[model samples]
Target chain A: MAGHNESGKKKSSEAANDLQTFSAENLQNNMKVIYYSQTFLSIVGGVIAGILGFKGLAGFILYFLIMAISSVGLIAKAKFSVHSYFDCWNRIIFDGFFGGLMSFVLFWTFAYDIVHIF
Target chain B: MAEDLVLDTAIRDWVLIPLSVVMVLIGVLRYFVSKLMRSYQVPDAKIVKEGQVIVRARNLRSGANFIPPKAFRARRVYFSNEENGLLFVPKGQAQNAQAQMFSDPNMAMDMMKKNLSMIIPQTLTFAWVNFFFSGFVAAKIPFPLTQRFRSMLQNGIDLSTVDVSYVSSRSWYFLNLFGLRGLFSLILGEENAMDDTQRMMQMSGFGFDPTKSLSAEKDSLDIIQHEWALPKFEQRAEAVLRKLVS
Candidate 1:
């Protein structure tokens, strides 16, 4: 019974050490890094989709695939310790997913029309 | 898919390319214009101090568990004490801030400048697109859309038979207007004033009531039940070290 109580205390103590405090500057810098990378990746994806004559659902699926790859790259960049740099997993995985969508669509349509249609 | 329109390549050269190019140029131009027009108003010292006090109080509240109970109590009292606390703005002065904000001509001038920088180029761009590329079918999206999007995607072109994927020139301009936000952020940087949506949000959320925020912070600070976590952290650290040694 004492061993169980001791283990419970140890667990609570360990949990205390996991409390995180993030500075505004570091958080903002992390966000900027994500935004910049996502924007660049989305544009590239759009261009590739456009060049390959991707149409309809394929183009959007390609965008999401690119974003997924970007997320993986970000995870690798963070060395798989996303919690050290970000407050939540979503910050790295899904932060700029939709923000980059318009750029992807814009470039996709531009490239598609230029290459295939025109 | 309905029969695809074999659009003139001339429409591509004349309407589509120019409209996009013009929009990009105008976005860059607007960035620089807003940059030039942005008046660096030195924030009032009292406002700055109030902001700092609020931030410090918030930090103290959030980090209270890291500090000793006595220290947390002292800091909380320093901020939220009923008589002479930093956050205790008298009722008279709190009401005066609204009148003061309105009475300040420079604040109004700054607001006008911001509105002008945003409004002028936007109207000009819309007018230019409307006048030049009103009814022309510029380009087709690389994706299918539902019939619900026909009216939106085919604006200015009153064609009933055209595919919803086919974007009219003016509608394409609108697309570029909203879609170029990512490009602008890439080119101009994150906090640029080129985004119309952000500017509209800022315009609507114009008033920053400092007293209200300060009192709210004070109330929040008062309620923080600080249980010091450092003792637990130290025990955890010691246990980890012992495990490493074993």
Candidate 2:
């Protein structure tokens, strides 16, 4: 416990010099940006899926699969240094994923009906 | 299997395309409007001083272990000393500063502007969508939804024969409002005020509250029990050196 405490102090001291810590608000703001981009991609994905006439489960699956690819692109944008990203945003990636999934259905259905039925 | 009802091509040109375009334009306009409405206030001196005092105390606690024992002892004594210590100096200073910030007329005015900027565009767009595109079931969901969402998703349209999955045009506008955060970020960059979802959350008291945060910081600082880590540093360093020699 003492050794852990010392290391904790050392890390905090380093953080003290650095103005920005991993505060909740900062993390939320960063996650908001990530979520926004993901939602955009998901909407576009839904539209493309709709245009192709993929319906029901197939459409849902295809939309999420496209989102997973975007996640990979995001990780690659960070040069696969996921530890830093995870350190800053642990739960946010999942939140964005699920949130994107919900909206993907909405846009996917809209585009599909508009394109296929029209 | 249910028979698919064919929609006219003009539906896309008239409803879907126009609604999508309007949603994007409104988001862009809201971004610029909120930007114009932002209030950048000069930070108060006492707040800055209080922040500095806390940071200095934190630095003393964390970095003291790295310094020699004599230096560490001096800093510890200076900081944790009861009567004149930096940590406890003017205990309610942060509280008063935070209170003043909350009560500042400029802050209240800025908040009003922000709220107005968020509220006006939202109400206008909602009213416009409702006025123009009230009854059209703009889209049909591929998957099934519960009966509860029937009223929400298909707000203006109500048909017993129509499945609950069909969403009205106004709901589509609302959905686009929430879903277009990425487009806003793409066009205006991150941190734009085009995020209506986030703005609503803030207005509803879910987002950043500065005064509460200030008080929380003060509370955490109050309970901090500083422990000196320099007393056994030499022993640890000597052990590492011995290991290297061996």
Candidate 3:
């Protein structure tokens, strides 16, 4: 009985020392990192749009369509974990979609005018 | 309105390429400088202990309901004891002492250092772009904007004829500052603080200082009412056990 109590105490202490893993805090941070990567790629897309001289609605439509395809590719790359993709849908999908729009316009202008305009 | 406005090829070679290069280079430079400016001060042991005590009290308040009431009372008694309860610090004395500790002069020094590092590079780059790349309208945005945005987007050029969608070199620089968060994180790893977009949010908090975070946590913890959670817990447990057995 004494041995069992000692082992139990040891286990409780170990649990105390261990930090919370897979908590809400960690999930939020992972989403932020994913958002960061998405924003980066979206700017690259803008640059590409500029280089290719795509304009107005045509470029805008193509940009999102490409982002959708890339998002699917990302899902596949995550070993088909569809749940992870939807975990932070607000940040990963909607925010990334809109937030990327500004930078896309910025770079798209620079690239398009530089390549095609003057 | 996909108007085929003719642009000279020379504008691309001179203005667009240089703007892109300068923006990327400045971003890289700012990343390294900010990293170098970051200060790591070891927090006082007493402060750490105080914070941990509150956390323990919090855990007990929430989760002790799972244990028997006797065990819960014992833990509560240990924390709420008159002589040395974890939460029983003399309120006025503790607050005064913490106010002193939180007002450490090193905090101001650290803030000054951080501001200098962030500002100096940014100002220098802004000046450089203004001097070298100010005259040219670098690119036209794919979408339209309001006339009001012309002042912002078309900074250097003073032309009513230029479409509101066209952006000058100066506006492009500002756009790149917020936009390249991805590129920096990709090159330097996700943990890097190179991008200013996040920092911009932090700065807009205005007068909120970093040193007050400890005291703020304490203040938040102090306000929590810790009614014990273990009363009638055994009855609930027994009902569950009986249900499972049946």
Candidate 4:
């Protein structure tokens, strides 16, 4: 009975040690790592979109929209599992969707507004 | 052919563009009632997902590059039951997530409802975000070709074949396709809350942790004794970044 009790105490102490080790610092760092990777991807996305001829305001807007989608996507991943990261390829595709839709609508809306204004 | 091309351009300038204007106008008209046009409230987070596996599918269109067709159902497992009511488990991995919904009547049913009441959002995040994206995707596609392309690219996933091993299978899961995360409330219970949780969940999905819980005794140790941990973790983060982007 003495031996069993010693073993139990040893195990419980070890377990407590382990649990305490995972403090808020660790969780924050984990979150920070995710935050940085997303920033990296967003920077890369802007350069690529700009280089591809979606330049100036349109390019910037395109980048913003892509970054928005990417950030949102990454946010979703982080919020869901605290594990997943940005879907690089999915973000690219959705950027096209978001960019295309926004460009098309912005162009559409501007035309109508101009006609009425002028 | 040139005349038709001119007509097309002219119509886009006049008809299509202005029609899109009307769409937004109507979108605003129904904005208060419609989740599609409104910004949803991000729930005060409870249990963040630890890890998830997302399977994405795209169509092999005959012309032009592929488009996203479907993202196979996303399944996320919670790290602990302590997270149940406080953390919003996605609907994708576990449906409804009401412990009472479990087939086993022996499970604590009433307490489960109490938990659901205190925590889980009136609307799930992923479904809420999809409203705007889906409407945008829908309004833009005029051709049957693009429509078919969208459909073929979006929902063509076979979720059953995937291997999703996570802590407690009861955590929520989401099925995202073509900017639409499948509606859980309508399929499970709440119909109006879709827009609220949809986008929030979509944003959170990127940050999920794949590792299950790790209990390390040294976490509690004094910093002087554990100064070695930070660099080691930094190294691990690099490895994880490589694997994540790869």
Best-fitting candidate, scored by TM-score = 1
Which candidate comes out best when scored by DockQ?
1
Superposition TM-score, candidate 4 onto the true structure:
0.23
Taking every candidate in turn, the Cα RMSD to the unseen true structure, in Å, is 7.3, 7.8, 9.0, 21.5
**What TM-score is obtained by chain A of candidate 2?**
0.69
Candidate 1, backbone clash total: 0
Candidate 4: residue A89 lDDT (0-100)? 36
Please report the TM-score between candidate 3 and the true structure. Answer: 0.71
Collision pairs in model 2: A36-B182
Across A6-112, the per-residue lDDT of candidate 3 in tens digits comes to 11111111122222212344455545555665667677788898888787787888788767865665556444543433343454456567667766776777677
Q: What ranking emerges by lDDT with the best candidate at the front?
A: 1, 2, 3, 4
Q: Candidate 2: which docking quality band?
A: acceptable
| TM-score of predicted chain B, candidate 2 | 0.73
Clashes of 4: 61
Which 10 consecutive residues of model 2 chain A have the lowest summed lDDT?
A1-10
**TM-scores, all models, native as reference:** 0.91, 0.71, 0.71, 0.23
Query: Model 2, stretches more than 4 Å misplaced?
Result: A1-40, A71-81, A88-95, B55-81, B89-99, B193-246
What's model 2's lDDT at B87? 52
lDDT of 1: 0.80
Candidate 4 ranges with C-alpha deviation above 4 Å: A1-118, B1-14, B35-246
Candidate 3 per-residue C-alpha lDDT over B1-246 given as tens digits, one digit per residue, 9 for 90 to 100 = 435556667767887777778778877776777788778888878767777876776676555435666776777667766577665665556556546555777755766777787688789988988998886777777677788998888888988887888778898888777766555665666545534455565456334433244345445444544443345445556766777899
